[model samples]
Target: MAEEDEGPQKAVADPETYRESLDAWMKMQMPAAEDLRVHAVDMPRATGFSNETVFFSATWSQAGEQTTHRYVARIEPPDGGLFPIQTRECEISCELQHRIMSAIKDSGVAPIPELLPFEPDTGVLGRPFFVMEFIEGLVPADVPRYTQAGFLVDDATPADRERMVRDAVETMGALAGLDWRTMGLDWLDVKAKGQPSLQDQIELYRDYVDRELSGREHPILSASLDWLDANAPSAPVGISWGDSRLGNMIWKNYRCASVCDWEAVSLCPPEADIGWFVMFDRMSYDDFDVPRLEGFPTREEQVAIWEAKSGRTVGHTIDYWEIFGAMRFDAIMIKLGDRMARAGIVPAEPGISIDNGTTDGLGRLLERQGVSL
Candidate 1:
């Protein structure tokens, strides 16, 4: 199998120094343990662009017995990462992510890793980070495109692929149906006094693109934003897994083991998440020009699964949200391309971000809707 560019690396420069600091921090968090040692501290290569994810194991002796615990720490990037680290309307991204995951775990609406208390003291690792019990499962790889290769294509039977799609969509639907207020997650609602949540989300992305562009123009993104504002759908607000996609899920036995990546969680209509799910499906297969592996549900079939589980009529709202999803994704790609250039992972001129498949797909979607950029 051929490997694709994994994008920029976010690992800390010195693992030994970080390990020592993390070991000390663990000692403070686990006071009762004797001879506690942190080892195998490593920054995983297969991680998203938003946070620096570190995996490590700690062993401690207590009551004359030794216990080992494996953990994954999500550390805020000092550079504010791919998105703005702080915004007036929301908490710090890492802190917000932790709180959202905790709330979701409490609600029991979906599966999440067991979370530890969030540590805000930058002294621990030079940045705020949260720890969670490490989950072991196969995650669909994004590098080579899962639709083209990997477990889903090579190992999974057709029935297994069907089950995977069903479970994944059902999980997304359940999340879309969550009562944010009841779950104490209303803090995720960042809309102004009378602004619709969907509009607020669009504005937020608009602002993000503006800041990322820093005076450059993304005409496609700008036009898409206008279209979203003009054709925004009216729907009930619900929890949105901002970056919903199969690649973000951990699977075991063709069932979703856990939904990872909460950095993009927010309060939006169910269509926000549903749209992202389907849009990503298109990106993974259609945009990549890879034939979707047999057994996976069709785009419409997946939406039907979501409708059944969420009890919400998708109707034509999907068309609107799909455009919105593509816009958001393209904006992120812009930021990603900028980050990669600044880090020298890729050249800055003629950047890969602006004219990539994401933007192309966005253009096609917009053109299909008779919206011109």
Candidate 2:
């Protein structure tokens, strides 16, 4: 929750100003006015932060008829972090989107919307923003505060929920199995200096955690770091979705249409992803009484499928990352909670929701270590 004592370049751009910039980008990108027609452009009321995402309706009128279109726009935030949750810059995010969609093009992976266009320069949208064809239908698991309100109360049928979960696992498995090294990305430079290998990634994240939370100390976090260092998997890192979880993949018609927010897709061990996934499910203690998810895959079934394809085994060290994952999410939640209290950006949360979420996550982590939360 503490502000960075040391500094990195920070930029703050207002939403309204950002939108105007994006609209200008649309105009420029589609300079052929006759061919391009935009009907309506709108953003969500309560903005979400996965990226500076906004929704817009585009109507294309060519020659005689008008065709309606909808799109989701995402841009980099004004303030950047040394090693923050936003993950990658526009370059990596765009590249991942391209590659993943390419892989799933002909498959039953549910057609992902195509990227209409993007501009890397901050000149447009005050930062990089990309527009993609927006797919219709409910996300299935959402706050359901807006366009998706009706489905929120549906009490999803068992068959539909199972299909959605299976689809998610299949899509992710396909992605992790992808051969990303052939993308000529060996020449692609990562901003983090030491990223020639997985060890570099592990060490970098560990160091960042230590430095960022210099004043705060968690014994489990320290233990997790040591455990990972001592047991680095020798297998070459594959495409690991840095933030692979059910929440990230939304269901459309009992299928996952969008596998998104690829700002963190990178080379990492298959176990790295499975461990993260397993721990995420474990963190939720996702047994019963969960609102958004009715019932989903057990960690065993998901791991079995991934293992059958990858031929890898998960061990003790990964248990640490799972704990660390909880720690990472916990830290974020704590920061959000603090901001809610200090700045009153949303509702000055009296620290209720995450208080229990963190407690549960910690309990899961401690259980892994044969301790109690």
Candidate 3:
């Protein structure tokens, strides 16, 4: 469910104190700086659903000169997140996240942001977090659904949109093209549990959906999940950036400047990433009931571009993964919806029809594949 962001949301943490803490922490990290101070810290208007992000500017004097830097910190949720605490054996640690990006820094798949550090200790920020060099660029709005209205839709040229899409697809291809084994990232591999990787993921989501709904039946979501199990793809696991899409990319010059949001990064067939990329892009238009913006590649065009860039034929398996992607996002929305309901933000609809758009989208995708839902 790619729901629109109503407006600029507030930060979960205070800016002034957080900046002071960050200033002290960075000073310790830089032993050489005699006088290290954070000039300012600002929580950008845009906030992510899962993590609390903070931006800071600091100036430190080493010897007789002063140097300045801007950094971004991604703090993990303390209680829990939208998704379940990933199974430890198959989980992504903050250290692993840092390693993943570091390994691919030279791959040309995407502009890799420089990572500052991965702090596992929570005492500093009341939760575990990591930092990266701040990248100045425009990101398509997730809350506003870029297609509905935004800097991207309102001001970006049609040619700019096309280049953005192309760059994103190519970046995804570059990520999938990397040698995971050589990169020493085999720790991310999950045993299929006597089932295929695709099916394993579906069951995980099914269980989460059950938890989210408290065993309440989500007919359309359940139907889509069942269809995915019945029509699972046979492709082997590869490096699938779990949250692949244009919105996840920070853009400059209409091309991907840096790829963000790797919390759901996983090992799945390349089709999984392709499916996510296409489904999420479509959700912006589908959920908003708007026409696809001009120059943005169609689903077919996206797949073809990825195939050309990654050198892997999408073949017929993409539909199965697309359903899986929808189901995955559906389960997330269910949990997120439940969270909102508890907070009195929205009514808790028993039928969970609020996810109808996502389910409807999934149903149509299944039908297009000739699978009865």
lDDT of 1 by residue, 170-218 (tens): 9999998888777876556665343337777887888888888899877
Considering every candidate listed, which one attains the maximal TM-score? 1
Candidate 1, residue 290: lDDT: 88
- 2 or 3: which has the higher lDDT? 3
lDDT (C-alpha, whole model) for all candidates = 0.82, 0.55, 0.74
| Segments of candidate 1 deviating more than 4 angstroms | 1-12, 45-48, 83-91, 192-196
Compared with the true structure, what per-residue lDDT tens digits does model 2 show for residues 142-242? Answer: 34321133453365666675676677666666665655455434422244442455665566566555654456655455555565566555666666666
lDDT of 3 by residue, 121-200 (tens): 66687666788999899988877788988877889898988898988998888777876666666656555242236555
Query: Highest lDDT, which number?
Result: 1
CA RMSD of all predictions: 6.1, 6.0, 6.1
